[model samples]
Target: MGETGKQVVLTYEGVKKLEEELEYLKTVKRKEITQKIKTALSFGDLSENSEYDEAKNDQAFVEGRIALLENMLKSAKVIDEDDITTDKVNVGCTVKVKDVEFDDDIEYTIVGSAEADPGKLKISNESPVGRGLMGKKVGDEVEISVPDGIIKYVILEIKK
Candidate 1:
């Protein structure tokens, strides 16, 4: 059966990244993992070969990740950045904000759940910043409470 879930709306960039990952997994990564398994099998002793065991574990993880990506792709609904018309926050918007308390400027790209990367400042729609930023227009100030503190930000720009 197909993916049984609501379709996730991913930004154009997010979808592109997913596509790239899928390509790499199906091509380069798959081959590399298969070779690893094969080489480990040559060591013999399926029950005692540490290399074989490690390779099997790695294979399992890789296969699981592949399945997950395939499912997401199956259920993905790619959102066209150009079609989202608004000065407000959106999944594809790169928001630049000035901290209310610390007086620091931070930039983030709002994306779907699969694309969250806090270190890179790409937040998921389910995140505090992403949720707070959504539907807020430029110049609109919003408060988001993080594990650090409740930080405030002004919506700078929303782009396609």
Candidate 2:
């Protein structure tokens, strides 16, 4: 939806989150910054007014964020639920893998780059682990190359 070159893949939940953020920025944050600017303007002497300058900077940041959100939304592609399959690794699927070296099972929710939150076990398809898991089904073993060394994992489960 964005310009010809830009494409942003997102899940339904990701789209909702972005829409909520955009709404908050346009309504609440915009108003708060506008009020700050008005209060600063009342101080008079714009050349020496640090408050005014700060408010202007805040306004610029907010506007830039708004524009960025708009562009992202324009290019957003929501992955459909129907497209999710447990037979293989893909974005929007949850996968459980056993570390060959550690002998521990780790779960990861594969998502687009826009929604990658490693702390929450959500990984981007571009990540080393995610890339190694792509198109792999349960019982498949993968060897992923990381910066330190190669990590080996066996796919335990895949869920929608």
Candidate 3:
């Protein structure tokens, strides 16, 4: 058994990325890239063939990525969007925050690292800000000390 019986909370975006990558690997990359390998191999002497070397390298990388994605998908526990609520902070919940100092408001979805895109305001569970907001409720305050400084954030809203 795994260390934690609880399932991992993953955002829809995170799941999509994995699914897309897996599909691409099994369909497009596998067939097309493997063909590249076959074509390169047909060139005969592979010892000094740059084309063969590059193709082999690319093939290795593609296959390795496919294997990795397969493993992750096998162990995946996708979090349902319906499981999120505005009552309390949790993974998949879009958290609206207010900077207590600068009086600025920002919204972010607390998701797994795989789906976290800072520019998109998606935070990772491992992030300090995300950690501080976990299990918090609206109107609650959370303080996190970042590299810049310690900033206090107030929970404005939590949504699915």
Candidate 4:
């Protein structure tokens, strides 16, 4: 669905969310699109039917999303909460770090890409800062290169 054999990593909560979305797309969205198509078809002249064209486009988009969700779910590898450890920064672990340059403290929850929400401080494990912090214990200093510049951070704590 994505790559030939690329695995989609997700947390249990992430998996649940995806499943719920897939369900909604398959049931509610599909029905809504079908109703729109039926209504457009009843309007007559297919050659000048902008409503029909728009409904078809919406149907196509919904179908594509359904396929994508199915593929992602099929390839999902859900991380178990019980498997999370505080020995180091890892997926499912929340790590606190102090910015060495600005003297600011921030907490980030390392999650799989599917569950990453930067606004909420849930960062993808593949992100620069997350990658730099991985396998690092408390007191470890890390320097990560971002688009802006290199940021230096000292690990303060790690917890599940």
Candidate 5:
């Protein structure tokens, strides 16, 4: 959590993934970076050593990522799978929608920002389409505004 006190919403799987990444960064990555730093130090001349500079930069990035992961975990609110319902569009719901213009059907899993992966069809609840579909029923029609333009979609199904 940051000073804003905003909670980081995550599903059980998302939490597990983050935890695993955090563990890897703290254990394996930290040790590897430390070794690199040591090896670079052995080469002498700190000011002009490119290896040392690169190693230090990598160390800083790793430390920063560790801090970010820790903060996110501290503020994480895991959504229970059992609590998800098919009644309406909501986080953790997989929605099937028909694109009005192209007449194509697409399935999307609504997830939190931290778990949103467009390539995997996992959309954030705050996204344009996700927001437009939120609280909508199976037969509901929605118009979502994207960077390109407005897109119309009809909700066909909602499942947990």
Candidate 6:
């Protein structure tokens, strides 16, 4: 998301995850795609070879992702756990919040844009909810405006 050449902030775990993914893409995935291409070449008739086309497309995608990951790693800045405080919501903090409208309790781990996994309840610091929650402490109430509507959340707790 930081395509403007801004430094990408990452947690320690985020860095490790990116490193592992880059390694897998470079080694296992690259080899697999190469074998697929070679096998497709053996089948002859390059003009009508769907396998060849698919393999080539996959190879391009893999290479592109590898380059993106490499660039991100080059500009990566890891957030130290020791520097994280519980006084307020910030990047790398786990926060428990209650939705004022729905009356539902939700937990989110705020992280850098690169490590944000919404399905896993890990939100990017740049996200609307995360941005609204930042610098907020327990008992603080916040209203986040989104495209759909406004969401109100109360800060219940903050953890490391």
Specify the highest-lDDT model's number: 6
**Candidate 5 per-residue C-alpha lDDT over 37-104 given as tens digits, one digit per residue, 9 for 90 to 100:** 99999999998999999989999999988888888888988889999999899999999999999999
lDDT (C-alpha, whole model) for all candidates:
0.80, 0.91, 0.80, 0.90, 0.91, 0.96
Query: What does candidate 3's lDDT look like per residue over 15-34, in tens digits?
Result: 77888988988899879877
Top-TM-score structure, candidate number: 5
- Which prediction has more favorable TM-score, 1 or 5? 5
- Candidate 1's TM-score: 0.86
TM-score against truth, every candidate:
0.86, 0.90, 0.84, 0.93, 0.95, 0.94
Candidate 2, which ten residues in sequence have the lowest lDDT sum?
1-10
- In model 6, which regions exceed 4 Å deviation? none
- Candidate 4, residues 82-145, lDDT tens digits: the string is 9998998889899999999999999999988778899999998888988998899999999999
Error of 3 at 6 (Å): 11
lDDT of 1 by residue, 59-159 (tens): 78878878888888878877786767666777777877777778888888887888788999988878887898888888998999889878898776676
Q: For model 2, how does the per-residue alpha-carbon lDDT over 12-56 read when each residue is reduced to its tens digit?
A: 998998899999999999999999999999999999999999999
Which 10 consecutive positions of candidate 1 have the poorest summed lDDT? 1-10
Residue pairs in candidate 4 whose N, alpha carbon or C atoms collide under 3 angstroms: none
The C-alpha stretches of model 2 lying farther than 4 A from their native spots are 1-4
Give the better candidate number (3 or 4) by TM-score. Answer: 4
